[model samples]
Target: MVNIRRIGLVATLCASVLSLPAYAQQYRFNYSKLYTQMKNNLEEGHPDVKVAFFFQEHKTSRLCKIDKAWMEKDKHYEEFVIPPSQELIVPLDDNLRQVGPLVYVNAEQGKTCDFSMVVMTKQPLSGEVSYQDIEQLLPQMSKMLDDLGGMFSSWFAPKVIGLTFEFDGVKQSAIQTSKGNTFSIDNGKAKVNLADLSKNESLLLPQTTFRVLPLLEK
Candidate 1:
């Protein structure tokens, strides 16, 4: 009799679980489409750009040469590389963040090399992000961007031009851009003409999460 009652309870719980709304499930970020767009843009814009890969130690800004031994040991963890360019895309996690694919620009005689740093959350984010989560991720993304900037050689003259955030909601009017700044969101993507956020670290609420692709120029 007890076994029969327990089985009935389990079935009831299973039915309730299945009836939950779709939003309750994990939200998916379309990384592939964005990656394809990034590659295409790089190819069209940076026809002369050169790219190389280097292994960077954890928590260190200096990038080391990739040796054959490291390859054999599978120590070379590649996050993402935009072809024909040495730009990197970082998976931004509050707990487990991996930074890599450090940009190595070999500019031609009189030209300059430019690229962007992409910071994205590792896991699928909810439709709504709490204030606390945004607060926490703000510092993490800022530091990661600064850390990447530090890896650049002084001669490159790295400058932050602008940044874009790709997510599933619009927070345009709610967000206050600086003077002469306008926020635009079309099909779940928004852009900010701001940079070096490490300097200011101002908060943009309700973005939930982002793949922070910042255009760096010479």
Candidate 2:
């Protein structure tokens, strides 16, 4: 006779193990790989390869204040106060200016809040960037963006907010998100369909501008 209790336990264990990958996928944005890729592009003289780091701070957090007690001992605490919408330009060739992980505190709750950095790069990136490039990076990038959002908001998910590629001086930007996997573009008077380009290359063009934003749903 089949042991019903043992079978149930086995099924439970299998479900738990199967869910591990989905959980990891939910929180695995890799900043190190991103930094390396940016550095490489800069070294190869990819034209106008600019990197931007975005940070978010809560309005009432003590860390947001210039004279917070924690700031006395922390040297890099000031960087956290930069406005979320503002961009911190990172010099890809300069190690000192490269992006790194950062930590912050919420004084009211006496709890430490962590932030995952978001990066934006603009340049001529046709062959350099693509859906495949993003697909590979999305797992990590989504986790990072969601981490940042978690610092202040109770609701957050992974999303790509903006992506634009300039081809022959005609700027094409992603205008809409379809099923959270595909994006439509604003071709901007260009004869060629930007969507077709994305489909063909499975990559984002180099010298492209893109923003990884938080999604409301996974």
The per-prediction CA RMSD against the true structure, in angstroms, equals 22.6, 16.5
Error of 1 at 108 (Å): 24
| TM-score per candidate | 0.27, 0.28
The lDDT per prediction is 0.31, 0.30
lDDT of 2 at 153: 26
Give the Å shift of residue 41 in candidate 1: 25
Off by over 4 Å in 1: 1-117, 151-164, 167-184, 191-218
* Candidate 1 lDDT score relative to the true structure: 0.31
Candidate 1 lDDT by residue in tens digits, 1-218: 00111001000101111112331211112333223223322332222221112222223322222211100113443333333222233333322212222212222222211211233333434353333434444444334333333444234434434444555446344443323234456444554444433333443435554333333442
TM-score of 2: 0.28
Q: Model 2: runs farther than 4 Å from truth? A: 1-87, 90-118, 121-124, 128-131, 151-155, 158-169, 172-201, 204-218
Q: What is the lDDT of residue 36 in candidate 2?
A: 44
Which digits, one per residue and each the tens of the lDDT, describe model 2 over residues 41-88? 343332332334332233321121111111112354333343333433
